[model samples]
Target chain A: MNNMEKIQELRHFLARYDLPQDRPPLTLGHPQADAVLGGGLRPGVLHEVFAGNWSAGGFAVALAILAAGTKPLFWVRPDYEAMEYGAVSPNGLLELGGDPRRLIVVRTRNAADALSASADILGCPHAGAVLLEIGGMPKCLNLVAGRRLAFAANESGVTVVMLREGAQAEPSAALTRWQVSSAPSRADDDDWGNPVFDAALVRHRAGGLGHFLMQWNPEHAVFTTHPGAVVAAPAHRPAYPQERRAV
Target chain B: MPRLPTDRLIRRNGAPSKAPLVVSGKSGNALHVHALEARAARLGLYKGQPLANARAMVQPLAIVPADEKADAALLEAIADWCDRFTPLVSLDAPDGLFLDITGAAHLFGGEAAMLAHVTGLIAKQGFAVRGAIAGTSLAAHALARFAPAIVPAGGEAAAIAPLPITALECDDKTLRALRHAGLKTVGMVAERLHSELSERLGKSFVTRLRVMLGAEEQPLTPRRALPDLMAERHFAEPVVTQDAIAAALLGLAQALSEILEREGRGARLLEAVFFRADGKVERIAIKTGEPLRDPKIIMRLLNQKLDALADPLDPGFGFDLVRLEALLAEETRPATISFDHDENARRQIGFLVDRLSVRFGYTRVQRFVPQDTHIPEAASAAVPAQDRDFGPETWTLKRCPDDPPRRPLRLLQKPENIEAGFPLAPDGPPKFFRWRQCQHDVARAEGPERVAMEWWRNPGLTRDYFRVETKAGQRFWIYRDGLHVQDQLAPRWYLQGVFA
Candidate 1:
């Protein structure tokens, strides 16, 4: 009976040092998508986003903004990536409902430098997430390197998003793998409207696969399924409309 | 040694010639002997003798052209090695050095012992060495050439009296004039009237003589600025293992941290110097974002730099001395335990930025600052994070809420030319376009948003921009140059960026 009491006391002491297991995941606000992802995108793990075309880079940026919340986001990219896929414009990020001031960019000389920088950034629990963009299958980003990155993220509770462009899918330690491409705008809607993407979940370690036609609402900062998913809150409708105006 | 050019050549080649070797250089229209080996000097090949004449004097002679660049580099390196002894070491070009050991003499014993120790160590490296300590640099320069003797204070006049006038190291013309005047020694020149000597030579020459005799002091300009604080270790036997070097660094860092803690300050720029046993020195330096005093942090930064070096540190013949110096020390605010999570997180992020900057570069780790300009590319600027003067100005996005992003998610370094046809409706976006070897039919378009260039700063034609989405849903931002009638040229279109 005395030993049991001591064991209980030790367990209480160790709980403070361990990571908080009750931290809620980030919800994308789309009911169906949230249900498939087991509530939302989990933190403290690695995720991979494969760009089906050049336009898919936008999908990766949107995900990062959602995961980062009010914290800072660190982006690491190689030197050649800027020339090939263009530079990340902070002005554009602001239009996508992200605070440009919260972004930090680390431009590395090569893929190896980018990997090393990502590891260092992930070790800091203060950082919200890291976006690492690599164009090709560099030898430095093999399975071992991926595992190391995953370990760092899990240890610090900093989400990592690896955006791969122009490369084949390889084995990785990511919790979820996605293939993203831009989708045609709805014909009846306004020509100039929010961005839409056809995202397919090819691999999920904890759940099943899914294909989503998600539309990003910049004003509300949430994703909405187009066509026949659900009736969204009207932009013109005031809140508590059923209550009559006293004036 | 006076024959540094010849010595440097022999040491680098690693093999000596069977015949005597000499370094030659062009003097006027003829080749003259710059320096020669000991054997050549003994065979009566004096410097300044014509190379042609030396060949006739000695049947077997090996001659090499003088390389003053390599010789100067070697002299500079030797001066770097001497830095371990004292911080104040100056270059005496061609073949000599000036070491001002005023208060440093007692550290290596007395004046005489220090001189003996220095000359002995240099001699072991296969080079002839001579050193002396005096009250002034000029007095010591004259004494070192004559012999390795330490002159007593206030006895310079009597001690330099018997030395030849060549000890002054004056121009050849002055030496010739003195020789012709029947004054071969310094004492004979000192006996003459000051006015008479001044009238013959110049006021500067008289000053030189006075300084050499200890009547005045000539200051020596040191090679580097003195460090704010320093710690060093000298090994009795050369140390070659990595563990030993690391242990030495750890001890030195601890010593430095204790010193810094007492003063309530930290170092911003730290330098580590390694002195090899064979007269080679390597200096590695690191810069921090904030004043840092922790020994562990300093060790980690140094380890990162050493690992990333392109050419790894070479411990040839092992290292005899290692030194850690704080080049720039600054007062730091005492760190208080933070109760707020956000503040603690910010501090930790600042440290991460410093480490990344050291690995890549300061310019590579950057944060975006809003620029007060309307030009697309000039709207925002990326500056090094360490600079930390970010203005409170926020990015003013152009698009309205709930509308598509008018700006592109990613912008090319510069606009690229594209092939497109004129729209059916005038002053509108192109109907069809070809880009990157793919043809796209425009399904929707928005714009003709006219943007004028900054006429006063960089005058150019105005551009009409359009946001177009293809049938495949890929969006592009394209702009047409000024009207063909106004610019008197063909209307051209360019792809500026891509929208997500």
Candidate 2:
């Protein structure tokens, strides 16, 4: 009957239609390391990767992640020199199907801003995956502000990967943490041969410590086990009765 | 009494009231009508006498000065106070205010109540006030100044009937014409036919008269409409420190986030308003790189921006109210978490880089993106620090014709000139070279890679680049500028960039 009444009626009608739901998280598989993850990477969760001495292994893993799909990936490299290690040698990543359009690389100035931004990207629903390079060893990142990112990722379903350069004593809230090291190459004549890598799944929420030797095939852009590659000794191997010593 | 520009008329008790004469005297020539309560009062200096004649009547009459600016400022304050009732309030020149309280009346419990409330408030503030409700601002203004202080709805005509012809607020010339036409009371002129009156007085007379009679509607322009989303916090105890302001900011940001999340949208721009105890408002704003609804992230960004303000947060007395508003918003999809360990790690790293870049300069942090161009320098661009692209795989290692035979380890920001002579062919490196106050002999040489500048651009310069290795095993990327024609000057050599 009146303008107010009309507006009220319209508002009630609009209230009935629900808002559009968010897009499902995008899945990505390391072409050379499918078996390493069982399937492909899940859309939403925090994953940690430890790089020991060999920086090239970390580069290869980063390349593998980028080449996995067309989804846009954000790469945040805090250390300037470390970025050169990945971009200078074009062997592993250049050969993979890494699209520049889908990648964003950022160099942060300080640790605090870097950490905060890492959390922000995890909270963003539209981001396919965010790659952050933490120069030092892993620290307690589960502060009040830090936990917001985990909650955001869980709520919005965006995957976040924290790459810590050195070793740490304590564990983080990451769903999975894997230590990656470079293994000897197995190729004889091919210029673009497969590079074998030792990936130790130190911690996993799914309950098992999955330590397996994987080979990264540059040509196939996938990860598989090499026949002759040696796997590291299991962490939980029971100490032999003779080897056990009293503290 | 004679009219004086600098004097005001006040009752003996300083109270405003309706009277026949209340003019104040200004100049010595001003005619003061009367005086009371003194020896000058015994001199028959009545209040209505002309000032000049009053001087002649009594030389000792007390005279008080008037301040026009003070009066104007006082009127403006009253207008500002009127804003509480309706945002559409404007000055009506000299001494009146026009407020459009149409739809706003309901908020104050109807027109009569709102009018009574405003009048009561002004009266309590020690000011004489009058107000009227009419269809048009001009009509209400005329009614308030000339007719009674209150007019019932639909009584505009009857209320205006008894008022003098001056109630029209016409110019002196028009009033004189109306007086000459024997039209004294507004009711007499209104009683005549509209066309007849217009023919007698002028077209404007009929128009103003019609507006006064509710025949036309006048629109009111408001200052600003209420924002789409608003969050406010009032402190129990006023806050005067930056820390307190920041804490308030956090609360506002959190509240705003909830509202934004419910709508499944994010704000691109946000503004925080700090309302001080003394009624002054301080505002701070921030623009996000992307639409975001996360309260903590927004608070961080806003904190950075606030820290950049030149004025220190001196709340003076203190800030009693803080309001946060999302000025611009966009629809956003929900974010997802990563399950893969490596992927999740990468996401976290990306976030870290973005935050660092915001604090530092984006240019300081960058990603190397391979370009499709054939020129060596054009092969890649340094992308700003953030999540962008790793670049196309096809162009990552594609060798360009303009690439040096042996790329230098580093590329200087700009080329430095060098003097050298080539012992080999034009495409070969120099046998001897001098650059940066140093001279070296080339034991080995590499072929030159010609790179032509973009001719379409202004001041384009072409150069033939070469990678030369000296006897000491030092590699340098050198270029010869200009063409090597027979008559042209010898090519100028300069170093640009190096390769590892």
Best by DockQ: 1
Runs with alpha carbons beyond 4 Å of true place in candidate 2: A1-247, B1-228, B234-237, B277-282, B307-312, B335-350, B361-413, B419-445, B470-474
Q: Report the C-alpha lDDT of model 2 over B144-245, residue by residue, as the tens digit.
A: 876535565567777777889888878888789888889898888788898987887789889888778666665655434434576887776889888888
Candidate 1, residues A1-247: lDDT per residue as tens digits? 6999999988988654333333578898777667777888878778899898876788888888888888888889999999989888989888887778888899999999999999999998988889999988999999889878878888888988999999777878777777887777766554566788877766666665567778887777788887623233332232223211311
Task: Write the residue-wise lDDT of candidate 1 on B282-401 in tens digits.
Answer: 998888888888999999988888887889889988999999999989998886789898778777777787788888888998889888777777788898886663336568878986
Number of the predicted model whose TM-score against the real structure is largest: 1
True contacts kept of each: 0.77, 0.10
Model number with the top lDDT: 1
The C-alpha stretches of model 1 lying farther than 4 A from their native spots are: A1-22, A186-190, A228-247, B12-18, B152-225, B389-393, B449-461, B482-489
Ten contiguous residues minimizing lDDT sum, candidate 1 chain B: B482-491
Residue A76 CA displacement from its true place in model 2, Å: 12
